[model samples]
Every structure is written in structure tokens, then in C-alpha cells.
Target: MCVLGYCAGRYRCPNCGRSYKNKVNLGRHMRWECNKSPAYFCHACDYKTCRKDHLKVHLISNRHLKNVAGKIRYPCLHCGKSYTMKNNLRRHQRVECGKEKSLVCYVCDRRYYYKQELDTHVKLKHNISAKIEGFPVPMHWKF
Candidate 1:
């Protein structure tokens, strides 16, 4: 698919199929983002991110200021639900926090927070084949 706003590709990420114009940019993406779990976390909040710079921004943002007096708790600014582990809070925010699920199953009208979850639900629960139904399976889910 198109990446960086153009489709005439020179390089592509094997994990995510994002195209790039050069190997250096693709290599950088692989090293930093592609298929990589978040490596940086904010000690003050439930904020976690793949890049150190994002964690830095989160720390500087007003969200980090909500840390409870002395206890090591991470509270969601959107929902006020707390988590002890930064990763847990991050997951909660990404998967089930106050934000609406934008991805919906066409067959069942069920909603999901992530594309992978919605794709899986469409595949297994609906018994629809991606090849036959023209459902676009996520690149990471391809066998």
C-alpha cells in the first residue's frame, strides 16, 4: 500500500507493508517501530510508547501531572480507572478506555478497538474467508 503519501515504492516494511522510498528509512522503521513492542514508559503515569521521544512528550504533558500523592498508581485521565503497571494502563487505554471503538463488524455490528480484533472476529465468528469474501486481513495476521 501507499506510505509516506506515495505508492510507487522503493522499499517496504515486511511486518506492516508500509512502503518507503529508501532502504535507510525502511531500516529505521524496522529498528524503531515495525512489530516492536513499546520500549519506553512514563514512571509517573500509565503512559507507554514505542519511542523514547513519545515518552518524553507524555512526561512533559499535563497528563503526567495527575500522579497520586505517593502511591505508585497510574490513573487514566479519560476514565479515572487506575492501574499499577504502565503497560496495563496503556492496554486499557488502547483497548477499553473511555474512547469509542471505531472499528465495527459489518456482519454482526459488534465493535472493536483494534483492526486485528475486528478482522479476527470477522474471520472466525462470521466464518468468512478473506480470500473469498474480499476481507482485507491485516498483514500481521497473514499466515
Candidate 2:
């Protein structure tokens, strides 16, 4: 096995069967010589990407954001809540309205409607450590 480091070492290209002294040189050779097809060519915007999944995700998220920004429709069934995007409405139903009952703590097996509620429950009830998106869980005491 080749040692993983930032040093020039003898390596072989898998695609072109070419020997290179460094990984960076091998990668450059592959990019310029071996892999010529652009996998992630965006049809609408004419954007080129090497990764197909990234381009797909970009297209999907761009369309979703555009649709969300355009119109406000679709009301929640339970609480009469309205949202501009169907995805947002689905997220709201799952998180805020307690429709799907999806949020559950892995450590304590506590069920919560929203992630915020779950964090509070974990902190207050079980005293177990939990974090959400790098934010520290807030302590809420019932008075």
C-alpha cells in the first residue's frame, strides 16, 4: 500500500496505465488525458461539472427554490398552516404539526414532534448529550 502523504512518490494510473511520481501529477494526467467526458453538463444553464450527482442536486435544489420563491400555496391540513413550497409544508407537517411522529432520539428512545422539542426532551428528561447543527442544546426547566 502507498503511504498517504504530501510527498512525491511513484504511482500508477488506473485508467491510462501511466506511471507518475506523485498523486497530484497522476490526477492531472487523468483529468487532462484519460477522463475526457464531462459527466455533469447542465442543460438549462450550460454549466459543466465532473460529478453527476452534484449537478443533479444543483438542478433539483435550484428548481425547488425557484418554485418555492414563486407562489404561496398548499395549506397544512391539521393546523391550517400555509407554506409557499410543498417541501416546506411537508417539513412543517413532520416537524411542527406532529403529523408523522418521526423525530426520535437514538440514545434514550424518546419521541418528539420537532427536533427542537427532541433536543429539549433529551436535555431535560434524560440529561443525555445531544447536538443539532453545531448548536448547543438549550436547558429548559419546568417551573
Q: Quick one: best lDDT, which candidate?
A: 1
Judge candidate 1 against the unseen true structure and give its global Cα lDDT, from 0 to 1: 0.72
lDDT of 2 by residue, 1-143 (tens): 54542233577777656778778877876776566666666665666766666665655553533555564466665776666678998888765685556666666666666667876787788786565467443343111
Query: How many times do residue backbones clash in model 2?
Result: 0
Predicted model with the maximum TM-score: 1
Q: Give the TM-score comparing model 1 with the true structure, all chains together.
A: 0.36
Cα error, residue 84 of model 1, in Å, equals 4.2
Q: Considering only N, C-alpha and C atoms within 3 Å, which residue pairs clash in candidate 2? A: none
Model 1 weakest lDDT span, ten residues long: 134-143
Per-residue lDDT of model 1, residues 79-104, tens digit only: 76777678998999887887678777
- Candidate 1: residue 40 lDDT (0-100): 91
